[model samples]
Target: MADNHLGEFLRARRAALRPDEVGMVAYGVRRVAGLRREEVAVLAGVNADYYARLEQGRERRPSAQVLDALGRALRLDADAQAHLHRLAGTAPALPLGHTTDRVSPALRRLLDGHPGSPAYVVNRTLDVLAANALAETLHSPFEELDNLARMTFLDPAGRLFYTRWNWTAQAVVGHLREAAGHDPDSPRLGELVRTLSAHSADFTRLWNTHTVRGKTQEAKHFLHPDVGPLTLTYLALDVRDSPGQQLVVYQADPTGPDAEALTLLGALTRSAAL
Candidate 1:
């Protein structure tokens, strides 16, 4: 029998893909993205009816061979492929509570070691599990905010912090959507959503968009109260043996106000400790 959460995950992934992007053409009117039932079936070398049944949540269990074929057909990367397996119930399900990754000592050292760079450690949910002095100084905490998603959605300060507020908020929601697939039953995640949705209408709006994105290198702009607007590039590196932990590092853009602001933020951090 198909589980509700499993069906939701499959539906979310199905919607994330598009026809043109997946090398498929409807040749007529279509109601959905990516390959249609027939197209996906053809690509996966399976019967159309079987694929339809699988999509409809009538077939919950698929063999590893079938999942592998479907993954290729979908052009899924390793993380996305794992998400597909979890959705199909081939992988063991986890509790959707607020399961979090512990900040490793080495990771803490890594963040502290990068005193000049704005560095923080985040779990799959984009929770700011910890931050070094530089990151803490750069982004103001709102209502005692530490979580990235919370700040992006709930904090007025964070709204001011993000130069492009709308886009930044949407990106956080999109990132959370991607993380949800990695672990659906985590109560901690459920609580986080409940808190933000209750407080921020914007969060609720973006969450409904159903967008998803993997953690990758990207640029961010922040309007710091102390130093003005600063742009930075960020990248997340996966932590070994930690399924959800990733260390995110941010560096100032070499040109423009970001460079000046970064130097100022660094000085602010050093002076504060003096």
Candidate 2:
């Protein structure tokens, strides 16, 4: 059988949607989960047979207009809609295959410049390419800080480190799904997903959800081993020169106790090196 990612995605999303969510009365006992294929076809303004064909992988090429309609019907967000388009070969593709792990001198300098903030560079597969002292200190609890997904799912410290462990897991899986949509041919990504799936049941469950999202600005909560609770806001910026590379920076409120804790964390790292 062909590796039908598009069909799989469509099936997952369709199964996730509920009748009431789309203002349809779910009459009688339903055998299947979420909306049926015919319901989605009606909502998307497409023929039932055509939609079935699309989901069965018989039809691969979908027009932008049809995709837009389907996106609306499925209640996809901006990122997911783009991902759908990319999967259908309608949108511009992202950088394919393994991205370079090397971080530029300028980028390293930039990371170091943010002395008060914790900053790190990660690729599509959540591999940590490089990190500043603060960033390293912030994630010191992890046995292996190489990959965020591995850290989140495999590391013993992950549950203790992330205050909202479930939310972090969901986000990580969703981001991975988006990455898969971008570079379906990436061996590294495939390996990472396989490893996570084999090891972590939580990762496997979220992976099956087909949630697609990119890392944007978000509030992250952490329980630092040394400093207790720390809540920080992080921003994920794309590296223009390095495709699939994202510079993630975390900041605490300047006047808050979290900032003081961050400073203390930095001091601990510096002291350890002394």
Candidate 3:
């Protein structure tokens, strides 16, 4: 089947929007949930047929102005708008194929430096390439910390570990969506999505939303079995040497209870090793 990511994205965004949200008044019984094709065309200042064609995959090349107009019509945020451009071929897509999963030694050393903090590296697909001692200990509850998405939805411990599972799930899907924009043709990503969709209804729901996000910076709350509750702020930085790898560092204030919990967690890890 011909992949129509652009069309799927447009349709998903359109269905997610409401007429009243865009200052459009409903005239009659609408068959669909969101604005009609004609309505979007009117708002975007493009011909209705042209808009329809774009959504139907008939019109592959859309000008930047038209894309900008469509973005406005869909109420796309900066990330979603960038995704739209990438889908439309207006922006440079990310490097294709599987990005190297190996973490460089220097990067490993950086992760080691954060003994008090939990630091790990993940690829674009959210695979845990490498993690420091504290980082591994933080996610030790999971059966496997290989892939964040899989562990989140597939693993039973995911729900128990993450205090805010819904928010975390949304962020995971958004990150995957952003990755999709980069490599729409990636088989590895395709298989992951397929497996996730097959097994996880929540994954299916959020995947359909077509929301785009990256694992940039966020505060994560975890309920560790050994250490109790922990709230940590994490920063995700893209590794300059590796195209798709990201170094994520989780930190808690030294004076805070969360930091104490982290300390205990680290001690527990050491005890287990011993």
Candidate 4:
């Protein structure tokens, strides 16, 4: 519902950092959360009023240098820095409908080859465009599997499916925020955000944080109804031909219990499909 998302992001990031983390001494009882607006301005080597204006949406377009400085001051990682640039209107926008939900045949072949692992493809907006049998089995417990963001927040089973629900929720929201920055005018994305914001308070809270991050390599813990508890490492690979599509593969250590469970689950899935 809020339109000044860039400002909201800046404000949230500023509120997340503490004075001590930025090498500033805290002498008095702080009245505000995280670093004050003045503190961020000082750390980034910018005027306080100017930074204030940036957060207030009065200054929509910030120079690249300022954005870089702000990124540094906030201790943002590479993805977050890129996201900051996008929010500040310094990054190039994706052409409307740049991302397609259609999965390529080559990608499908790749997914088919990875029978031992759960492999799926998602677009910028976290839409599950394509999935292998293992991947489908992996997410079979969910009522809806089309959109990862929606399932992560809106579904009642999401909390149980993701062992670390809070972390996954935050990561999903951050990824969506990053996507929004690149494709600001996406109708589907706008609709998804509005829908999630209205349905889930937790989604709304995390969304308000404006954190941005790409889905990279991570260890994910899942409590699959069929597989029991499993821990798998996932890799997110960009589909070079499809600009905004990512091929994600999840695999458990070959000698581990999770791998055995996954094998059993695969067999079960095959039987069910037949």
User: Whose TM-score is greatest here?
Assistant: 2
TM-score ranking, best first: 2, 3, 4, 1
Regions of model 2 farther than 4 Å from truth: 94-98
**CA lDDT scores, all candidates in order:** 0.75, 0.91, 0.89, 0.88
Which tens-of-lDDT digit does each residue in 42-103 have in candidate 1? 87898988877776777778897998898787676776677677656687754544345678
**1 against 4, candidate with superior TM-score:** 4
- Tell me model 2's lDDT, rounded to 2 decimals: 0.91
Summarize candidate 4's per-residue lDDT along 163-266 as a digit string, tens digits: 99999999999899889888766788899999999999999988877788888778999999877999999999989778889999998899899989999989
RMSD (Cα, Å) for all candidates, in order, is 3.9, 1.3, 1.4, 2.1
Error of 4 at 123 (Å): 1.0
Give candidate 1's error at residue 237 in angstroms.
1.9
Better of 3 and 4 by TM-score: 3
C-alpha TM-score for every candidate? 0.77, 0.97, 0.96, 0.92
**77-146 in candidate 3: lDDT tens per residue?**
9999999998888997445544688889999998898687888999878989999888888888998779
Q: What is the per-residue lDDT of model 2 for residues 1-274, given as tens digits with 9 covering 90 to 100?
A: 6778898999999999999999998987888799999999999999999999999999999899999999999999998999999899999864454457789999999999887899999998999999998888899899967999999999999999998999999999989998888888789999998999999999999999899988877889999989999999999999988888999999999999999999999898788779
lDDT minimum window of 10 residues, candidate 1: 1-10
Instruction: Evaluate model 2: give its TM-score.
Output: 0.97
Q: Per-prediction count of colliding residue pairs? A: 14, 0, 0, 0
